[model samples]
Target: MCLLLIAWKVHPTCPLIVAANRDEFYRRPTKPIHRWDDGSGIVGGRDLTSGGTWLGVTASGRFAAVTNVRDGKAEGTPPQSRGALPTGFLDSTATPQAYAAAADGDDFAGFNLLASDLDELFWVSNRFDGAGVAVEPGIHGLSNAQLDTPWPKVTAGKAALAAAVSEDSGAPDADVESYFELLHSTDPAPRADLPNTGVGVRREKQLSPLFVRTRFYGTRASTVLRVRSDGSFDLTERTFNSRRQTGETRIEETS
Candidate 1:
């Protein structure tokens, strides 16, 4: 996922609320969220090319998401696909911290990963020595940077997400729609505020919004998930391209 806005322990009934958009090239083969054929008890989109996933959840209350770090230089290809970071987390019996600590940072390209179990959230980055940090509860944002880095989009997304949740008066449907609206914005940040990720000004402008659009690359999927303290949850995935949308899939489940 390129952009993720999470309201962790901010809602009384819902412990986790996620609004996220995944950006990728249109040519990459992908499948929308589904029960994994391997009986992993996991549900999320799969990267057909890499046999991994960017984001997914398990019935046992484990959640994982990943974003590629933006490095200007190309190192050809890494030995491992970063998507496996999340898929492996959901598939294993390990805690989030153990899984993150075990990752061999040298095997993959630069990546920022978030892995959480029922009680705590953990963050690990291969670019930053592969140590894991527990994420505290509250509103948080992540993109192609360190956790809660004040990049323009991250800052705006966190604020928008906080507003969306606080304004939601216990209505699930309207609340989810409001969160989607926040993710659907395509406004570019002012040039002065764009982060210097080594990519040029023009490229930075293209990725400034919560939702991004470009000829060959853009947001392919948007997802909203709400996990209640009791483990019942609502998950929705919307797929689209630059010109128009493909479809939306909704999955609701209880513990």
Candidate 2:
């Protein structure tokens, strides 16, 4: 997941709201969101190349997501796939903090990970110094960089998510299409607002939008997940090929 917008414990009826986009090369092999048949009780899209998932939720009320850090530097090869970080947390019985704190960041490339056990949420990053920190209740955004780094897309996404949540206040469920609409915005940021993470201005501008598109690489999935106050959840994932929508899957589960 490249762009993750979260409204945690902010809404009256919904405790957790997530809107995210997974950006990757078009050639990568991926399977859309589905329950794992391996008896893990996990639901998420699978990275066929790595045998891991970028975002997932378990029937036991666990949630996890990951984003790679883009510094445009050559790190040769990392020992592990960042996708495994999230997969590990969802498959574990440990608390969010314990799992995050025990992670061996050196094994994987630079990444930011979010893990939640429904009662609490924690974030860990290999590129940062801390082990894991508890997330406060509110609207937040995360991109390739650290959490809430104020990039153009991150700021815009947070505002959009806040409005979506506010507009759906007192309702039992959020409007998933509104979140998808925001994720589909293709407007690029102004040159002055772009972040230079070693990528040149041209590439930076290309990746500035909430939704990114290029000749060979772009956003492939847009997912919206809401966890209600009663411990039920609604998850929707829309898959894309280039700029065209290819398929969609929605899942609802009651506690």
Query: Each model's TM-score, in the order given?
Result: 0.96, 0.97
In order, candidate lDDTs are 0.87, 0.91
Clashing pairs in 2: none
Query: Candidate 1 residues 188-239, lDDT tens each?
Result: 9999999998889999999999999999999999998887777767789999
Query: What's the TM for model 2?
Result: 0.97
Candidate with top TM-score is 2
Best by lDDT: 2
Q: Candidate 1: misplaced stretches above 4 Å?
A: 169-175
